[model samples]
Target chain A: MTLSKRIIPCLDVTDGRVVKGINFIDLQDAGDPVEIAKNYNEQGADEITFLDITASSDNRDLILDIIESVAKQIFIPLTVGGGVRSVNDVRRLLNAGADKVSINTSAILNPELVKESSARFGSQCIVVAIDAKRVDDHWEVFTHGGRNKTGLDALEWAKKMVDYGAGELLLTSMDRDGTKSGFDLELTQQISDAVEVPIIASGGVGNLKHLVDGVKLGKADAVLAASIFHFGEFSIKDAKEFMKNNNVEVRL
Target chain B: MIAIVDYGMGNLKSVHNAFKFIAPAIDSVVTSDPKVINNADRVVFPGQGAMPDCIREIEERNLKDAIIHAAQSKPFLGICIGLQLLFEKSDEGNIEGLKILKGNVCRFVSSKTEKIKIPHMGWNSVAHHGNHPLWANISNHEKFYFVHSYYVKEANSEIVQGQTEYGQKFTSAVAKDNLFACQFHPEKSGSAGLQLLKNFTSWTC
Candidate 1:
């Protein structure tokens, strides 16, 4: 009767290959993006997200080609993020079979893109990604793979994106990312309470309990993890089962 | 042959690919051409985005009459906004719909104490009614992917094939004669979705 909480597997891709980063550095190649995505789909991932970390315009077409092939096979919601700069990028990614397009740096650079794209495409397909890091008392938004500081309060940025017609927010803690120290509960809880739209907790999911904590403690509608699932440390079913055991409603 | 009526609003690739995956031998194409939709043995009216814009595109493309005609005569299938367009009107933009079915689309209302989000996104189970051909292989209460802000209301209870609950219980599926429609995206709902498309491929009624 009620909506089920989502468990999304994020594939960080660079130059058409899937790669994982530790603290946004120390890039490690996992495998082919297409093959890896298919594996996750088979493992019953609620949705698949492809973060194109490739900083070059030349490889944009490569990600599109990869998306095309995967879209032909996988039958789940696919979200594409990173390097999305304009409305044209949103259209291209959607045309290539992305169910949703997540905007990060471009959203911070030009908030109007969120309004314009959501107006034309509808808010359901536009996801605003806010990369945040702890700065003294509050979390500040970061851009360019968590490299540059925007000096915008993370909670304020999240509210602004929703006002700009973003249907969802992908909140990642730069501090907990890759450390697997579990999600920053305070950060996730604060932003989730502020926004009416669904929030996906990202960055520091190290185990199944961390995933459960993201839902129970953080109040996120969904949780995203990499490396652990990518490297076969645990199956997606294991995570869902664990969450279900802990009273979280998940599609099994 | 199946013609997925793409009025240029939502993702048509998933629908086209789902049909191709389930029954490759059948011919399925995403077309905006009214003639193609009218000629196809099965018609799929799939849409997303806002209802007013969807209505605008349908009118702009000159597909309103052709779609209404096909819905009356063929094994028609409508998904998401496609389902909404079949109603008489929608609260979104206060625009009128195709009026094939007698009802209006209303937005999900949440009071201060409710706190339910708008666009009820994500997966939820559908409680189907009776025995419709579309529910052949799909079990009752099977989960399906849904993303929408408005739902059909004031619809004839006789035509309601499935219902789902979010903030309130709403009609999620309907079947009138040969026309079958659902508010969920079976194309993106994994195996259950594929099976629904497969059933539609062979669905005669």
Candidate 2:
């Protein structure tokens, strides 16, 4: 009974504001990162992950201020990702009060970065984020915010990440990013089977049923969503209740 | 005041936050000092990550003696790896544990047909076993967040507060007089978790 289903709400921060949408388009400012995090905390979100999607791409100082603000205000665990390329970046983020640092593009480019950072900071602090999009009828890993295809199979990359010492896998389906259809069950199961660490299924979470399905069918340890949570499509309390009703274990 | 023993393993901030959320008036401090732990109203030992490192930290910081002393005096709560450390020993890294709970921690022996995964990581229902103040608000069959591979075995069954079945029934919560533990992250367990913390805060030992 050591396994627990995590309900994570992702905050896509750009220029210090929480922005979210499907396929990352027509983004609307949800609110201050700290404020929204507080709301999520009250709503019983198991954890909150802040994805600084624009920070590194724009070559700006990673929004330590926002992270610092949210860390100070929110009580739940905070995991920050995006543009974390080096061990130094990982150190900086952890020092900024992040409970965990998620590496995506950088880990794909340099798989050794995952091992190095995990060894230095311990694997529990390292989260390897895999952004996968269905290509040529196969799930292929993508990088650079889903703009660059690495031609690596999603399952193979996930196994490599675990070998490199990633404590957790944040698997996001790029094709389902904003679709609200549901999580890619096949992709989720593939990665979950490939790795021993906790797998957090992300993308295509439209409703509470989808979350239950992600955990039961996908065998995901946790479910991460962006647009649904950001736009107030469903509340964390409601989602947990729904999960419990469906016999999907959740913290009530 | 609740003394949260800090042995440099994982995040104590989330645990501190959870205590603050449930019992805002109950002061919580992360300290390695034996004197502070001895003087606190309650004690909480929360941990994450490997058992070997955590055990080394407890010894290095001289927290091992302090925690054992505090547990003898007041109600003590151990979360996740903290609970595993309460056992006599663990299969993880073949490390020695505090032996406070009169049990041993063993890895989940994955059956070939079951194909069950290790590091059981997710929410699972807890079946309450006995009367314990820490589980006042927590109902039977209520789910608690868990993330670990090894668990306590061969413990005094009377002290078992809750049990959960993954592949087989395992102790998810344990209580021995003033010493209490849960192999789940209550701070990360959401509202019900907060309520459990609140119950612990209000418990009169």
Candidate 3:
């Protein structure tokens, strides 16, 4: 009855389209977010996360449209985030077809939002995403998309988020993000061990081996990757098979 | 008609969408009306949020009798909070459950025997008690999407149909006569999820 490790594909959606603003591919055109999510689901992604990285005022409608379209086409669970500030925002996204909503900057600003939303929608549907960077032998929490340091230690913040009623933690290493070097194993394990909640190791997934290491070494309950799956470096099926072979206990 | 009891929690659309996707002509409905829910030949109860809130909605909507009646008479399915409500009481909010079955809902504890996380959120394997139609075609290793802090602990073990493990082995699914319930979210559990819902459509008491 062991729970299988999960592999999640993260999409940085902006202005109603998948943001390929990274150097991986020149997706100058508005890549259909729903279509990309569908492809990931078919490729055996355990779950798909749509991070609303857009700062547009009309971004809510676009994100809702994406959730509706993908929820109908794909059968897996969908998590949406970005610009979610209040409990109403969580309801809006959940009603729009999201199984869970990840709150980062907004949660840091008003910690009560996590408690309110969790009490209203259940902690299972609330995820607290933390963007952390190693600083002077310790990790510092970042906000506003990893720009402003909040002076809150990542380990302490992780515990606080859990105490505040967060169901899961999506920990992203700012330095490893986009570099594809690999996730910060020591940091991930530190947080995973610190809090009993599930840890989703995001950023720094450079290769197939990184996915396996996420569970084996970092002890993350789930591994979230972006450029690798988005750019077709390797499919979710490939990663799951690799984990299954490495005795990481993944659903194949 | 299939009535997905809308006691004002969880996602009814996901269940409706899954049924509609599987059998486009399936006459499935999400209704809070006690008469409609009780009259349906097949009923599915899917719920999320807090147990006390869910129970409040059920009582406020006059659905307590309807849900209990349907569970006894019709082919019923309960999910997540819907499943927990079948027990006697929950440690969450100190609320009394429907008490349709004999058991108690306890919070996941990290004890000396075994340390586990609360809200066991993720995919986990479910081992069925015996051959059951609800699990038809779903393999033993097939993982289902789950997100809950509490679970059925000291259930009438005789009725516990399926069990899963996080830090310790616990019941995940239960069935007796016409009632079938699980802690995992089939609507969010990918292919195996759709398959289970499809099986429910064809299952008979």
Candidate 4:
């Protein structure tokens, strides 16, 4: 069936609380990850992504509990990421109730991890989150939670990640993240067209209309945002209504 | 009692939790034992991952016969790979399937000039072909969460109970006698998903 463009509310968790910042820095407490995720579930969010921003920086056991609680209450799809290094980590997260497990630094560090995870858990459960920035006219990959810039090109990496068996790509614009300016249409569109896998456009979603633009212009299968849905600037329901009214198919 | 056939594939936790949430009184178990599956009041075969691995595990565990018996004898519900494996064979891994239904599974490719994403992952709507108890309380055009690249390309028309449009119209659900299988995941499909589980719990073949 022709799937509607998804509206995903992302919860960046650090120390078990959903945190937000400007461009992945200057962190501040937003709310309990489980509670906020439950709210989005009731509001008809298509999916929920929980990124343990400090997964590598601290103990990894913390987010598993949150994932368990959220997965129980939120019956939709739950994708958990950050600090995932191996297939064992993906197994532990899935056992804890995550429908999909996202890998970032590890996928970049060891692209074979993507192939391994996809083979073991199935490609449908593996997501490769790429944080990229526009350098001149080309997009370059970033690592360490979007702090360190990798010399790899964004489009080429996306294609490689897919070939390695990543079922979906969660592409974030490092430049526009938390800026709420809107998605990087050029970067998002470039990767979207290059890969056959579904692309979830994350970062820079200020208003409801930007969601429509992400699908209409960027060709993203889904649009993900942080501040807009987290702080109640726009409810997921409101965004779906706006998209439906604008002729962009969305779950209401 | 509902037995969720577990060959070490798919989201057994969510499927079990969904059943528990809908009908707390109903007993459910996710097991690989043929006896438990064959003895259950209802059977649900939920699957994910590659078809070849799923088939290998089923063969290694020797649960294929029990699954076939359940499908023929009781109310059976297959989800995603659970549904795909029922066909005769799949293009993926170029492997044989259960051969329960006369069909072939193949990957989704765009027929039009526009590009269509493989692994049609996300929420989408399904159009039911006929009225059935399993669809009880669920809207015909209800949206459900789906994540799959290969789908049943050919199957019996009488059994094709629902269809959905992606690159082109294709089968999304199937039903015959006591069997009901769908491409979308009901456990991950939110409220409508919960309702479908509830219907399955109370439904009598």
Provide the TM-score for each candidate, comma-separated: 0.96, 0.86, 0.95, 0.96
User: DockQ score of candidate 2?
Assistant: 0.34
How do the residues A34-148 of candidate 2 rate in per-residue lDDT, one tens digit apiece? 7678777788887889988774455435467777677655655689998888999887887666878999888977888998887776777788999999887789999765889
lDDT of 4 by residue, B1-205 (tens): 8999999885699898888788889999999999999899999999999999999999999999999999998999999999999999999999999999999999888766878999898888999898888889999889999999998987989999889888878899998888999999999999999898889888887
- Once fitted onto the true fold, the runs of candidate 2 whose alpha carbons sit more than 4 angstroms away are A1-6, A21-30, A41-44, A56-77, A88-97, A120-122, A135-137, A179-181, A205-217, A234-252
By DockQ, the better pick of 1 and 4 is 1
Chain A TM-scores, candidates in order = 0.94, 0.91, 0.94, 0.92
Q: Write the per-residue lDDT of candidate 2 for residues B1-205, one digit (tens) a residue.
A: 9999888876676787677767787789988898899899999998877888889889988888888887777889999888999888888899889887788999887677765665676567888887688778777777766767788888888878889887788888988878888988787666677888888888888
Candidate with more favorable, higher lDDT: 2 or 4 = 4
Indicate the fraction of true inter-chain contacts that candidate 3 also forms.
Answer: 0.73
DockQ of 4: 0.75
Models sorted by DockQ, best on top: 1, 4, 3, 2
For candidate 4, write residues A1-252 as lDDT tens digits: 367899888888888777762232222423667667766788899999888876455656889989888777668999998889989999999998899999998998899999988988988999999999989879999986478988999999999999999999999999998788999998899999999999999888999888999999999999988888766677889999999999988877
Model 2 lDDT at residue A77: 67
Off by over 4 Å in 1: A21-30
> What's candidate 4's i-RMS value?
1.4
CA RMSD of each candidate after superposition:
2.9, 3.8, 2.4, 3.0
Worst 10 residues of 1 chain A by lDDT: A21-30
Looking at model 2 chain A, which ten-residue stretch has the lowest summed lDDT?
Answer: A21-30
lDDT of 1: 0.90
